[model samples]
Target: MKVFLTSLFLACFLLIIAPPLMAVVDLYEFDTESQRQRYHALIEVLRCPKCQNQNLAGSDSPVAEDLRRELHQMLLEGKTDREIKTFMVDRYGEFVLYKPRFQKSTVVLWGLPLVLLVLGLGIVAYIVRGRQSTNTRKMSLDELSSSEQDQLKSLLKTSSEETETPP
Candidate 1:
């Protein structure tokens, strides 16, 4: 029983550390090399609307399969890459591409992360520098006027007198 448990644990460990699985099947049903290349390239660039993080070529989701089929049909119709992408963007919003287009709507998508990163780093640096200055503030003797010094001493004397006099 102990040996079986040890073997099962070893198997689980090996499975945990296994390399990423690539179930790459021939997706483009084409006799010519150029058609296949174009088909592959289009699929690779076209993002899966359902699984927005993965391209149609890399994702095995049902929507990815449908998107791939649609891309194949577009290729057969001799649509250029741009036309296909534009059709997709029109059908589903600009989120269909892995790289957002540099148009007005997506400008925030591209710039937001960078802006947040810069702002976050600026705040962190400010805080770290703030923490490093333990004794940065100091009063110079010349900065305090004699009248002000006398006022401070009088205030202190008044506080002590009040304490001793008990109200």
Candidate 2:
């Protein structure tokens, strides 16, 4: 009875401590190298619809697996890359492709940020230069009017007299 309990405890401990093992999918099942390559390529370029951060090949989610099988079947049926992609787009929309199509709608999506960055840099440069030029135009106390300069000279004279030692 002690041995049975010890064995059960060991089994539970191992189960809790073990790292998750990933199962290998058989790519060899495809008859031709081209079919295998096409399958891999299609899966690599496709974003996992369920996990937006992962490619279909890297994600083990059911949606990714299903898409992989569909891609394999499409390759077996001799579908062109364009056809397979079109089919995926029709079923899943443009979000499935990692690189979006270069359509009018997506042009701003690709180009707007870069344009904004350039415009922002130009504005910053203009503001910085304006400030620098204003600082470079330094004004001296000697360049003031007679009345304003007299007041400054009187202030300096009073401050100097207060700091002087008696002779």
The stretch of ten residues in a row with the least summed lDDT in candidate 2 is 19-28
**Candidate 2 structure, TM-score to reference:** 0.69
Candidate 1's residue-wise lDDT over 1-167, tens digit each?
99999999999988876644545454467756887899888888888888858888788888888878888888888888899899999998888987878988878888999999999999999998887774465565567899988887899899999899855
lDDT of 1: 0.83
How high is the CA lDDT of each candidate model?
Answer: 0.83, 0.87
Worst 10 residues of 1 by lDDT: 19-28
TM-score of each: 0.51, 0.69
- Backbone collision tally, model 1: 0
Model 2, which residues run further than 4 Å from truth? 1-6, 14-19, 22-28, 31-35, 140-167
**Candidate 1 ranges with C-alpha deviation above 4 Å:** 1-26, 111-167
